[model samples]
Target: MADTLVADLIVERLERWGVDRVFGYSGDGVNALMGALRRAADRIEFVQARHEENAAFMAVGHAKYTGRVGVVTSTQGPGAVHLLNGLYDAKLDGVPVVAIVGQQNTSVLGSAYMQEIDLLGLVKDVAAQFAQQVSTAEQLPMVLDRAFRAALATGSPAVVIVPHDVQQQPAPEPAQEHGVVTTAPEWRRSQVLPFDADLQAAADVLDAGERVALLVGQGARHARDEVIAVAERLGAGIATSLLGKPFVDESLPFVVGTMGHLGTTASAHLLGHCDTLLIVGSNDPWTEFYPPPGAARAVQIDLDGRNVGNRYPIEVGLVGDAAATLAALLPRLRERTDRGWRDDVERHVRDWHALVEIRALTPADPVNPERVVWELNRRLPADAQVAVDVGSCVYWYARQLQLPAGVPAHLSGTLASMGCSVPYGIAAKLHRPDRPLVALTGDGAMQMTGLAELVTVARMWPRWSDPRFVVCVLHNGDLAEVSWEQREMEGDPRFADSQDLPAFPYAAYADLLGLRGIRVDDPERLGAAWDAALTADRPVVLEVLTDPAVPLLPPFPAGAAKLEQMRTGLQQEGAAGRHAAELLETYAAQEGAGR
Candidate 1:
């Protein structure tokens, strides 16, 4: 029997770091590593994704849903390259993920051997916090420890590159005598909070203003009660970035919906009217939606100092954990006696909800995409986790779907990458197979990556405790988001060759995969379809043929400019633009009435 290889040590280190699974694909460059994983199968399960990119996405999803450092592995060259998209998602969203990449043998350093591309250079940007190439077996433990530590501390992607020869080398034991470093796999969260003076300053900002607005991002996930407490004390209305939507309970009467181009009119009203703005744990890039620079005095609280005062100019910045900072600041905050601002917030929220219902009930060519997700609001399971992809479906999800309180939902936020829904759904499911998952995606995204990831779902569903994985596809036969963007953003007519999607029977394909499939075109059948999917014995794909002409309406105030732009663009399209124009007019009218 040969001595245990360095690859074995790597797996052992990961186990010590509390990693339960690794998502990846294999190739010759990682043959030894794969063998070690097989040997350590009892310790750490290896999840084989259909592609390298999906594997990386799974890692990011794991990090997001579990609040642990997600790990991914890939072979040399092309496989290493394929991990970029997923890694970028982690970096941009501030999720922690560690990538273990295989490299060509060190002996072929300058020879340009097969799969010889430089791995360190490729990952440096995405994995800026930490990226190292291990040349010796003794370096593995330290490198792995630092990678995990950096990933967790910085909340970003980290990469470790091991050459084929290095992976095959004998595992090294602890060296006690000299400069060689040894490490243990451990990380803990610090109770981080800002100085007392800063907290008072932040509280002062909230107390002095009669009209205050609160913006929550994913960072405020654990501080739900604290956020509500602050809002109540300040008599402030709450708005959320799309990423923060799952963290806060949208069912709260004064809580307006998401903020952005796809956000709710109520949120636009709250932000526009408030004199003071409090941003918690969110670095949302929707600057245009924020109260025009000088309009609102801002106070931002973030664990990271780098993110403080990043999105909006602020009167004060508190670099601290959301819950801790809010709790400490609570004593300093004065309760507002006035109820007028609170009344305004409640009114806007109620009107917005009524408006969305009206939009959902409006007739379409086949089915309204808004209605598809709107239906989920009433039927979504309390324990269900949601994963959304980028497209028009994102607009619907942002505007309509009301997640049950405490149900965690995630997506490719800052990256806005398509085809992440299925992969993210898989990660969330595998982490807690007892909980059901819901994935919302557009037909264009299914074509991009969802179709192949569905295979991954099929392969894994048999072992899940609760096999209700519902993948709802908005099969609109067009890249509706981009099509609308062309008209709304650039004033250009729809380009058929570029915008149209080739028809695919998504539900039929799901059935072919031996999973239950439900196709609902009629608006009335949507409820039944969801019921069947949630109760099915196996995973289900619910495909709805939606209309492409239903416009992607921007939120109020911003929509004022976009509405005219949309009208001009549709008019330029001649006969083809008529349906879209009618829909846009209806949507615009609804926005005006709601606001």
Candidate 2:
């Protein structure tokens, strides 16, 4: 019988799990695995990344857009260390990623050999599951299978540590014959929780109450119609979490806009006046919305039984699929005495819309990030898939951008790491070649993660039939503008004056990567530049020199406090403090202006 190496078994397992490519860097510890990949190059391609962090970020983007398991590999020590940041981002963002890291030989596991580190302990916090492969020949398939399951089932990143000695060992006959196993969780239909009784109870509360509101989250994505149905039925105003924004049209009469720090005044007013609030598929903390104390009775519904009342006191908590629960309750819900509630909510929504037009998009001194998102919403293709990295850009895009039905957006990170934009862009293009993919990143974050993947995109463009990606960098050259405001609320006067970075020539970096680069300092040119990039048949970079003075439209006051703390720390301390203070001032001046 031919000698089948453990490395071959690992590759075979990955193939069975339907992984066609792995984004990673090569190292001495994983040389045998690299060799195995070379032999099977025809079936699975190994994408050599400049850094392991970029590889992990790319995997996240791929998984988010395509609904496939993102795969990444790294060597021991530093290589594995670099992966932690990106993996944490994936874990937080709920992206399913499978990472394979090489370790020193099993014999020297305890000894401090060259490049040897306790990889399992290092990644325990960031990874959902961590396992060390002891025997390349015996435990290869078992570990790989478990790693894949953990990542896919929980929508989190998992790490499998492959020791050098085991990877080089010959696999047993049983290992070679082992096939991949996948377990699909049975999704039972949402159970009816005494629908008539719940509906009657809810209707009684609404009828007796003068003001009412509806709150939605990601759980409401599929039940858009039902959400609208229930809102109309109850004559309730609607407010959504960051994840729930795209689920309903903002133009709808009931939409009071998003609720949080970035929340509109009208939404806050409506929430403040509500006598009862019905929550669907949302786990957003109440402290964020800051509902007026003792203002309303809360009814919550969610998929997971535990999440229903985990954060806030609830008068009623229903555990089931949001859409199913709403569908069952809608028939029994009675038309209430609140005749003009919908009209009132609609009027508030219209007034807020006018305010947004006047304040958010006024051709002002410094361009608003909100207006940029609005413009992108107007100009980009209806089905364009957008991947947003963390920071100010997240608040802007989450609150302002409007996605068409069926279009998807990716966010969430275990650690809220920066520099995810470029890698995500690459992954989006790889998974969905036909759709236009855009990466919205802040300047600081872009500089950290962008350049590394430009080369990768350049190399893959040919294979994808001239598939393209547009990278929009909001080049403000600062960090944490929104954090400054939160500090002020907490009584720290000095918290709002720190966090900034020296502006770098970002367009030049794009040019260096052989991508079509366009730089725009004036907001007027943003539309044209973005249009040109979208129309181009290749990868393009559009760098917008945003006002350094623009503050991020933070989602909550707490986030604003963090920004303040970051700023204060930057100003009173060393070089880092000064840099932070500068960034905060830039953001403070631009607060409410969008960008």
Candidate 3:
């Protein structure tokens, strides 16, 4: 038998790093690694994916659910190129994923071989770290260590490219071990300059003021108690950003609601009217809450000092963890002299909830996107994991779906990439097969990136117990809702009507995978179909046909400006424009139909 190659050693190192599964597709250049994986099949399982994008997405889902580094591999050239989308998603979400890509043989460096491409240069901007393997036996361990450490340290994706020939080379007599430890930078508890005085000053401001409001962000993930404590101390109303929604239970007394474009009307009212706005750990970049020219005065607290004054001019900028800062400021906070303001804010939130009920729940001829989300929220178990894609679905879920306190909900790129739902759903199912996993995806998004994963899920079902991956596809067959709104503002009333597309039978696609598939056209059958899928002890897909006419008003209005700019750039009808225009029309139609 030939001596164990460097690829075997690399696999051993991956095992030591606690990686049990690696998601990717196999190809010629990566044959050595595949051979090693086959030899060590008992130690680590290689999850062969239909697409490299799904592999990266699966890694993201795994990292989100397990809080551990996710691993993926791909072949040279086109394979590695396709992984970039998912890698970007991992970077934007602060998820740790290690990606290994196969490269041409070492001798072919700069020779323009068939599969030769600058993999490192391709991913340098997005990857936290990148490495190239020189001689497999001598350099594999060092490169792997560097990649793993960089991924864990920054909570981002790391890429490593291995040459085909080098991977098959035998190790030297004494293999060198690279020892690198990954650790997070210590977050010191420090009070900002004059923060104590500022707290007292803020308290005084609140003492005189009648209404107070609190806004929380992702930085407040673990500071739920501190937020509630501060809200209780000041008798103030509490609201959260879309990312911060899971921090506090919706049932809390002071929980006003979410803030932004898609935010509750009551929460927006409280933010607009409050004399003193306490922003805890939010960048507050969304313009729907803080529009230009006129907004309320605010006190912002964030660990990163740079984010403090970037949005709104701050009355007080406190630098520290939200939990610690809020805890320290709690003692200095005083109850508002007039309790009527608090009462008014609470009433506004209630009224806003009622308004949402009317818009989302009123029976319409076609299914309401809001009704589907509300029903899913009601039927899902408290601990069920939800991975939501971008576009109208995100808007609907962010505003309507109330996640149970502490349950995990994964969103795609903070950059807001489409087609992340299926991969995210697959990863969630892989990580927590026992827990019910749900994906809320729009037809456009599902078709864009995740359609291939349906086959991957079917193939992997035998390995998992009760692979209850439920996907509720909101099919609108058009993307005109947002586009129509934008056109209306541009003096083109007919633009919305021009963007419409034929609907694909998504149920047929699901059925092809031999999975339970249900199509729902009416609002009434949506609940029953969703419930049936969730209860089914297998992978199920529920295709709910929603109206494409409903416009998706995003939670943050600031994002709309960026989309409008994109729409303008792609207004022409060339290959790129036609594709872009088609997507936009489909998205708008979905939104309009839902409305």
What are the lDDT scores of the predictions, listed in order?
Answer: 0.93, 0.72, 0.73
Q: Using alpha carbons, what is the TM-score of model 1? A: 0.99
Encode model 2's per-residue lDDT on 1-595: one tens digit a residue: 1476888878888898889989899998888899989989999989877789888888887887677889999899999999887788777656578899898888988888899888878987888455545554666776777778778766678888888888888875552344533332222233445456765675566556567788888768779999988888788889987667767777676787777765665676677668888888887654646465467888788876757776567777777778888888787666665567777777767766665554456443356666677678778687677777778787677566667767777754335677777787777777677788888888777767676677787777767754668888887755644444444444343333455666777677767777688888777777888788889877788787665444443432344445655555445555634543564555444433321
Identify the runs in model 2 with alpha carbons over 4 angstroms from their true place: 128-132, 175-210, 335-337, 363-366, 480-498, 553-595
Ten-residue stretch with the least lDDT total in model 3: 180-189
- For candidate 1, write residues 280-350 as lDDT tens digits: 99999999999999999999999999999999999999998999899999889898889999999999999
Per-residue error for 78 in candidate 3, Å, reads: 0.7
TM-score of each prediction = 0.99, 0.83, 0.83
lDDT of model 3 at position 6:
78
Tens digits of per-residue lDDT, candidate 3, 345-371, equal 777666656655655765443777788
The pairs that clash in candidate 1 are none
C-alpha RMSD of each candidate structure in angstroms: 1.0, 5.2, 6.2
lDDT winner, 1 or 3: 1
| Predicted structure with the largest lDDT when compared to the true one | 1
Give, for candidate 2, the lowest lDDT window spanning 10 residues: 180-189
The order of the candidates by lDDT, greatest first, is 1, 3, 2
Shift in Å, residue 208, candidate 1: 1.0
Query: What's the best-to-worst order under TM-score?
Result: 1, 2, 3
After the best TM-score superposition of candidate 3, give how far the Cα of residue 50 lies from its true spot, in angstroms.
1.6
